[model samples]
Target chain A: MTGPRIALAVLWKDIRLDLRTRDRLGHMAVFSALVVVLLSIALPTPTAETRPWLPVLLWVVLLFASLLGLTRSLQTETEEGALAVLTLAPCDRGWVFLGKGAANLIALLGIEVWTAGLFSVFLGLAWGPALPEAIWAGLLGGVGLAALGTMLTTMATSARFREFLLPVLLFPLALPVLVIASRATAEALDGRSVPGLWWGALALYDWVFVVIPYLTFDYLLED
Target chain B: MSAVETQEVEKRYGPVRALRDVSFSVPEGTVTLVAGPNGAGKSTLLRILACLTRPTSGLIRILGRDPFRKDGPALRSELGWLGPEPGLYADLTVEENLAFVARLHGSDSGRVESVLEELGLAAMRHRRARTLSQGYRRRTGLARALLHQPRILLLDEPWNGLDEEASERLTKVLQRHRARGGTVLVAAHAVPAARELADQVLRLEQGVLRMLPGGPREETHG
Candidate 1:
């Protein structure tokens, strides 16, 4: 199979596996919802001053939930030794990274949508005109998260305490995506115009990470 | 021509060396059984030949091509590998697992059906791999590896979980593969059936490799 075709097969296989077991993606969505409820209970009512924190809090929850999705995404492959087959397949190893990233992107997007709907109802904030902007920021940020997370996941899979190590390694590297995404999302939620800088930074973060995984993933799988 | 060749290959993890000065060659259309005790580096050698790991400091080639280069995956496409782990997706049904592997090799579903039948897994085709017994799971892994009809097979401990019947079945399938001029390298502590099919047997111990006078049959049968 060609590179993209192999990637598509990987994506399809992951989707089917998710549909069957509902393991990683399901945990992410449910975890995000739980965080939303718990945080809402802990905080005071959403006043004009407190409402800004809502977007930051939402992104925070999504970010942590995304970590779960990323870590578990490769767990299945490792469990069955399937990564060996994937790496040895007659396509560039970068395609495996792309396939893994795309699958995580789809799973994270599901969580993103779920969190967005629930946060709106719980915080009583109207997306109004900012819904589109917020969505764009979320999507751009999701791409960055998935791309970097997949690379880090592959790196940590060979480690002893990968579950603990992935977040430690991922947070610093993923700082750009988080910072830009939070700022853009907060602006949209506040009904203020988001600066072009944050969007550009998010896109740039996505671009850098996407290219990096393509280049370094071969070594990561080299073992 | 040699189907696999490694010259003084070495694999070191920190201060410990897993493979040291390991050198061997398997002729095409033959089976070589790798015999060794625990920590003997049999798995490491097989992993290198399967293109799953690169040798630290030696020349290694599969089908006469450097497997650590850009076209490694292309070269590996013609080989099948079954590691110690079953490597079958637990969430996927037996048929799905075979089909998925076939797709990865750009083969058709017909191959998947044939392998399932060949491995006597057709009845359990719809069962999830996680729910299968150890023997069945091994069968599933074998089916996946053989689905593409690869020219070479790299198997690490193929006889681990098989019952007598399943083991016999696997030996027959492998004999048929060898009859078709496919090369096979199997790493195991004791594989009597494979020994019967093997033209060469190698022993690895403490990161070193040495040739045995006879096939593994001499070691196990008598």
Candidate 2:
């Protein structure tokens, strides 16, 4: 009905669709688990000896898996013509970006949870500075990833070779998130309570690049 | 209720002029049909009115608001659009798709069911949207656009995949919507066979617009 109201509705709709299919988010989980498995095989044993790298490993797995879900996020809307419908609503078009961004955050968070669980289980991991740091890093990293991923996804929707394009475009942009996530996570794994400067940087990136979609979304949706 | 007032509006796409010095006024509670040849700017005009794109230079107003500046959540509650795709969620069930938009507009409970029935999509309510025929898919888009009960309905090729019966049903619903003071701006190859449903006809060619009388529309029916 209103901005926030419709924003929530769009977010809910996107999540329901992705969650219902199981394939989209399912692929994200599977891809995430595979990464965890691979990391376990490559590095093997996640006792205190390997725990130092656990935070890095956790974020690496999540950054990659987030790709699978984000790429297909706007694919359905573009292919099905929902973008046009959304643009036609009396509300501003930015809500489509915001709504999709929120939905993406929810899905990415879901993938992260799965990846974290698998990492701890299969990698023999159990070490962190504090619960707050872990959650803060996760939320910060999750929000940044979703913001960057959602805009890139919208851009990819209108481009040629979208499947290839989304990954190429997303991987480079998400690199910063991975770097910050690794740093924040590394500090936590070492049991050294520290200021989350990486999270701050991540937040900075959100404000800059994520804002690109809103300012230009109308241009992108035009036929 | 005069819904749209555009004065000396000109739209150009980079080097190509989509619309040249175009202007028109559309009153509310009436169905204005737009017809044109290829690259004639039918879709371009629709985009401007929907506020998805801005004119290169001109003042265009819709229901007393500037669409370009008022967008997304602010504009969605009142505007309804059906473009070439009506792209419903391939993975979502028909009813779920309707409810998704319904819930967004805070009208989920009975809105989804009513629109589903109106579009004759009741039986396919539980079916995945991708599983439906082209006609049904189009209906879903139309249904979703109207799901919010918007004041202005900007539809592009809305009848692309509908059969006679479905077309008639859509026509009936539109008549009721128009009767209730809702404005309909349709971009199509030809006017709806229900000529009485049309209040005015506008044509575009080579970046210019020309008005066609109501009589020319009657010949379209025959």
Candidate 3:
């Protein structure tokens, strides 16, 4: 099969599996909701002084939730050794990585939207003024997180302590994404323009991650 | 020409050596049985040939091309491997699993239907894989392996969850594959039907390979 075709097949298959089982996506959604609820009850009312912290809190929630979903992204393949099918693809294994990463991006985007909605409803944070910039931040941030998380997740898939290994490997690498995304989001929430540098950094991070995984997936997928 | 060939293939896992200097070749249109005790590296050897695992040090050629090189992915398309696990998505139905594989191989849905019918899986095509019994799961796996009409088949303990009738059916399938000039390498403790149909027997003991006598080619190497 061609590279794009293989990727699409894998993408569709993963989407179908996720829909059928509702394991990874469902867990991430519920986890984010509970965290949001706890924060709403614990933190003081959303005042302008505290509102600046919302962007940070939102990014943190996104990071953890994305981590949650990323950790389980490959579970279906590992559960029954179905990853061999991917390793045996008729094209470069990178295509398989693309498909998996795209699926993860989709899942993360969904959670980002859901978390945003929860924040607005539970915390009374109005997003109307900065909706467009916030969305841009979310899109770029989602891509960065998805790219980095997917690669780390695959690297840790065969490890003995993968559940623990992913975060250890992910948190440090993901620090840049969190910082840039949160700052851009903070600016957007403040009704200010997001600097081009932040966008550039996020884009660069996403590009590096996506390219590295594509080049190395052939080895990563191997035994 | 040989369909599968390996020379001094060695696989090591940390301090443990799974396969040591294992070497043998199977001619085209023949069935070769690899017999060994558990942990004898039979599965490891098949995994290497399947391109799922790389040998720590060795040379392997499938259809006269090095599968670890740039041609690897293309070469893998012609190989059908079935390990202990069915390698299926349990949430998907049997047909969905097969269809996914077919798509991976750039095959059409017609091939999926064909394999389903051939394996007597059409009746349960819509049944979720998780709901199937062990035998049916294995059947579905076999159907997946055959869906792409590969030129070479590497099967590990394919007879394990099969009943008498299923075993007989598998024997027939292998016979037919060989009849069509396809190569088959099966690793198992013992399958009477496979033994009767085997063109050559390779014995692996402690990661060493020996070609048992009575085959057209005989070789013993450590």
The two-chain DockQ for each candidate, comma-separated, is 0.75, 0.51, 0.85
Model 1 error, position A40 (Å):
1.2
Model 2, A85-157: lDDT tens digits are 5665445556777888888898888887788778778886554445567777788889888888887777777
Worst 10 residues of 2 chain B by lDDT: B213-222
Question: What CA RMSD would candidate 1 show?
Answer: 2.2
lDDT of each: 0.85, 0.76, 0.89
What is candidate 1's lDDT per residue for B67-128, written digit by digit as tens?
Answer: 88876778878889999888778899999988888777889879988998899999999999
Candidate 1, B65: how far from true, in Å?
Answer: 0.5
Give, for candidate 3 chain A, the lowest lDDT window spanning 10 residues.
A71-80
Error of 1 at B143 (Å): 0.8
lDDT of 2 by residue, B112-193 (tens): 8888888898998998888989898888889988998988888887778899888988888788899999988888886445
Candidate 1: pairs in clash = A80-B87
Comparing only chain A of model 1 with the true chain A, what is the TM-score? 0.97
List residue ranges in candidate 3 displaced over 4 A. Answer: B212-222
Determine which window of 10 residues in candidate 3 chain B has minimal summed lDDT.
B213-222
Clashes of each: 1, 19, 0
- Scored against the native two-chain complex, candidate 2 gets a DockQ of 0.51
Tens-digit lDDT string for candidate 3 (A1-223)? 4999999999999898788888989999999999999999999998888898888898999999998898777687787778888889999999999999999999999999999999999988789888988898899889888988888888887889989999998889989988988888888878889899889989998899999999999899887
